[model samples]
Target chain A: MKNIKIRRLSKEKLNKPALHRPQASIESMHKYRTDMYEGMIAETVVVRGHGGTNINAYFARPLGPGPFPGVVLIHHAPGWDEWYRETTRKFAHHGYLAVSPNIYYPFGQGAPEDVAAKVRAAGGVPDDDVVGDIAESLSYLKSLPQSNGKAGLFGTCSGGRQVFLVACRTKGFDAAVDCWGGRVVMSKQELTAKYPVAPIDYTKDLSCPLLGLFGEEDQFPTPQQVEQHEQELKKYGKTYEFHMYPKAGHGFFYYDRAAYRQEQAVDGWNKLFAFFEKYLGTTD
Target chain B: MCTGIVENAKVSGSGKGPDGWYPLDQASVSYDHPDHAQSGRAIIIDFLNEAVGPKARIAVELTPESARNLVHAILASLSRGEGEGVRAKDEPPQ
Candidate 1:
């Protein structure tokens, strides 16, 4: 933390907030996977999201007819881009029907970087809107004929906090995964009027079985914050598993970024798959 | 890091953006996860024309060391009165 900084916001900044356009014209999808692996069909589509809005979303699922478990993949602070779509495919390859909605649609279809900046300027999506959108995503998954009725939610960065919030605020998710989400345990000063309550406060209401993946060195939810969250979960007798990898930080799963930690990211993915399988599938 | 709260400052004049030059009115600063910077942590400044769009601005993400240097340089330049040709009274783009 550099001590050389100042805190001052313009009145205009307070009055005219930045916004994200949660919209995108779904482009055609092609077979990005290898030929040997031909068990999934992925597509770009629109979902009936929060406020009854038609939001752009990516969907991928197995080719078979049997009902597969569903999982909603929430993107991080970064705008919904290639990685999120690929992650959706990854879930589909693992036998889960996955969908990731472009929550930035409200901010318009620009470069992902620009869209992210807009959302950040707006102080991230409102938690209530996030919950509503996630609920819509869950409903959409359940409505799919190929869905098994059981669904899980997985998110990274700020998206991770959304996963925890959805599990607590709504149902339909059989399991939840939080990947290095910062701000779950926000400081008092961090709590502003727009986002006043901390996600930790909702721990008691976290209905679904939860799995938390964390970076031990992550400053946002530092090792101390993780411990605090665990204490609350323990106090509530919640069923959960937490894995904090050493030498890892936020966005460790972002292979394209510098933070990508191969060993840690691989292990995190393994945990995610294992956790989802346990709750969303019949383990024999 | 979550980067937590972002600070905004009043600004004037224009910046060259993707859509050409646009009037920039505000600058938002924060220490957060950068969009493209390789650094795990960096101080970022977004000179924005909110009236236009998010793309209507200049954004910079600098490492702590570089940001400190930038601040010092900015202060030194300001103290040395570098505002002479900034507005340039009647000069047009050359």
Candidate 2:
């Protein structure tokens, strides 16, 4: 069997590059071979979210996977939109099962923009509800047959803040990435009935290695605020890495928006994959 | 970045939305990232009627300059209407 596998690999190499190459390292995650078979399935499915409510989620997974790490994507305050679906697929293309839950499902369904506006009007989703929903998503990912039994968290903007909150509040995640999450360091006056506690307060309970990517120009979580968060993490002796891009601002990873910064975003994504690989294990 | 700052007010008016006209009962104003505006951020205004449904709403995202212009226009129009003997009442129209 080993000799036959080697021969197949050799034959594939001679024909052209394979579409699904073995994930050897961070660099391998960026490269794709042309000749190899690559298939993925993406769709919207219902998952039990916070308070046992059945919420809609976009799920994507690679085909024919022996074992694959999982990632739960938390949508930004913009509600669940196309960018999130595309991003879920992007993670699948990289050999990981990805799921993005519509945390704003209770707000009603329509164009994402409309629903998000409704959520915003209601002062955003409660932190506890989001935490519950993400915990459920983590469970859903782990329950999959193809799962390698490891999962990571990734979120941008408000989703970023929620990822940090979830990583601190829950257990079992191997890694987490917070991309320019704002309001992590909220003032007493900024606290509302929904977000009663600052996420920074839970720093000591962080359950996994964390990677944070921030834009220096971001106003909500200013460079000073990021510094404050790092200090707290340091006080707890937590394992983490944070990168601040010089010319970028909040939501810099959003390619469809004016905030998109190509060079910084590319570097940030590379750092993200590397961090996840280090903590969650490479997709083989 | 999500500013996470929102201001709400009880408003009595009418707005045209995706489903046509509806009675608006609330207005929310904020300065944050726009859902459709091309800019990095903008002033967002949402006129909504919760009694109707979430879809019974009108939303606008405008640049700071545009928002300021809109504010000035509203004030100026109100002033002109009052000059033309449009009654100004202490309370909203019934």
Candidate 3:
């Protein structure tokens, strides 16, 4: 509850129609290219990770030679499952090389839910390890032949908190998006070995602009906590945007669950695209 | 909410698993989001055997109401069988 600067996004900013997206003229020239795949391709691979340990990750990217901006998608608490892989493809299909690494690879992959249960039993992944994994994921994306040397970070749920954590702990990321991340603001008594410190404390180290999507009804990151986050970013004069949707609760973007709110989720996605377009430096 | 807390205990006996059968050595109880429960969140119980890996286990996610009733049922069952269980224990009575 220490004091920090906070600012609510004004209606003028929130009402802004869209982000500046670079045109994709290659879509019109597919008949001339034999090197490109129809649109995009996705596959799983083992990437060198934290402590030189190899970890599994899902990589999705468009099939072209041109330099495409890179994006790293962090899987939510449910484990790296179908949605995360699909989201990676969505980014790649839209002109960015996106990768979502299996953050829980160490626990072994069985059913995503089952692996998630084991991870929960183990008290979650260590914060430092997560930061290292994301850093490596970002590096892997940057090394792609189609990479433009710029990368953005995006994630939902606990993964969203990781988006912020990695942006602050590592460098080279150009943009970041956090969707309904919980526990960014945890009390001292709540601290554990895995999450030794509140992510809010790392505000000053944030290396890139941020985009935050939240459910106004979320109790974990209640509106007050979002306010605190905004204030911290302001105190550091960090570039950022935040959207709090009405009539939405935690995990509202999860289409499979009862919390799904189509309108809000759709809008949140649009805003995310805009944010990425603006910061990832999209090009034709 | 991540809740992100776990209560652990040493457990004996076994539960049927994918591979047929396994010894259960531990149990972890947590209240958090569930993979299949219709409730927004639930109390999750994982009966596990670490030596057999993560999948060697039985798990349940119950709504708060359901969890409460389940607890009551377990207590009632235990109470009703307490005398029999106590008598069967191989111990030196003081």
Candidate 4:
């Protein structure tokens, strides 16, 4: 046998905590092991969405028989596109059964961009419809045989805002990650028929621990709005953590876009996975 | 961040789409993330005929500066056309 030297990560780097959990550490969570088996499958599947309507979703999961935590991804305002599919697979890579439903399915179908443009012209999907869809998605995850009976929510941009809304309005989600979701703290004048109430108003009803990541320069949910939201969560005594990155703006996690911030996005993703592992890890 | 700022107008015109020429009934202009534009945000314009479904449309994404230039060019061209006695006295069809 040939002698091989192995270098391990330092304790300071591996044990760093992403959030303010005194007892939890991130040691070994991100370590790579060559001996471990790894495989995943990703494809489009049909699931019952809001109002019992059949909708298409990108479903991804590891090639294993044991139970695993599930994650429902609410895609951004760009519509259900390639980025979302890749994200779904990413969650699967981390031992999560992930699904991202096409909320714009009812609007029309062609190319994702065209459908999204139509949705934009129609003034966006109604808040109620989205809530129903997410709730059903959660149910679908729980129903899967490979599920560990625990699920979390993850979303970015407009999807991020919807994550907060769904976490507040629906029940049974173990954890949630909202990445720069705008319109959560809408003003009186911003209210419309579709979005009649702000998601912050439902803080009292939040049923799961929330993790929020924001960029300091984001205009939609500006620093001030994030502060207001944090205040509300504090008042309700909710379990939550928020991190704001400097020199990054909206959609910083999108590597394909110019807004991608490598440092901040990587750090944000680490915190997100840590938070989900803490709240939605497999029970076995 | 999605600006959530959108404006709509009813219009009477013909737009060329993937299929062929279609009668346009509505036009929407919004400031939001573009699906294809390299910029983080853009001014998106969509010409559509809802009766013909989602594909019966033409879409454009422009950067802020380019959108401003387009606005200026549109006004200048309209002014030139009117000066040449091509302007219609009657109001456009609602």
Q: Compared with the true structure, what per-residue lDDT tens digits does model 3 show for residues A136-245? A: 99889888788889999999988989899999999999999998888888899878898998999999999999998888778767877887888788789899887777
Candidate 1: share of reference interface contacts reproduced? 0.45
Q: In model 2, where do residues sit more than 4 Å from their true spots?
A: A1-28, B83-94
Interface DockQ per candidate: 0.38, 0.48, 0.45, 0.50
Candidate 4 docking quality: incorrect, acceptable, medium or high: medium
Candidate 3 wrong stretches, greater than 4 Å: A1-38, B83-94
Instruction: For model 3, state the Cα shift of residue A152 in Å.
Output: 0.5
Which residue pairs does candidate 3 place in steric collision?
A5-A231, A6-A231
Q: Can you write out model 1's per-residue Cα lDDT over B1-94, one digit (the tens) per residue?
A: 2666677788998898766888988887878888789898888888887777767768899997899889767766765797534433343655
Which candidate has the top score in DockQ?
4
True contacts kept of 2: 0.61
Docking class for model 1 is acceptable
lDDT of 4: 0.84
How high is each candidate's TM-score?
Answer: 0.85, 0.88, 0.87, 0.88
Q: Each model's C-alpha lDDT? A: 0.78, 0.84, 0.81, 0.84
What is model 2's DockQ versus the real complex?
0.48
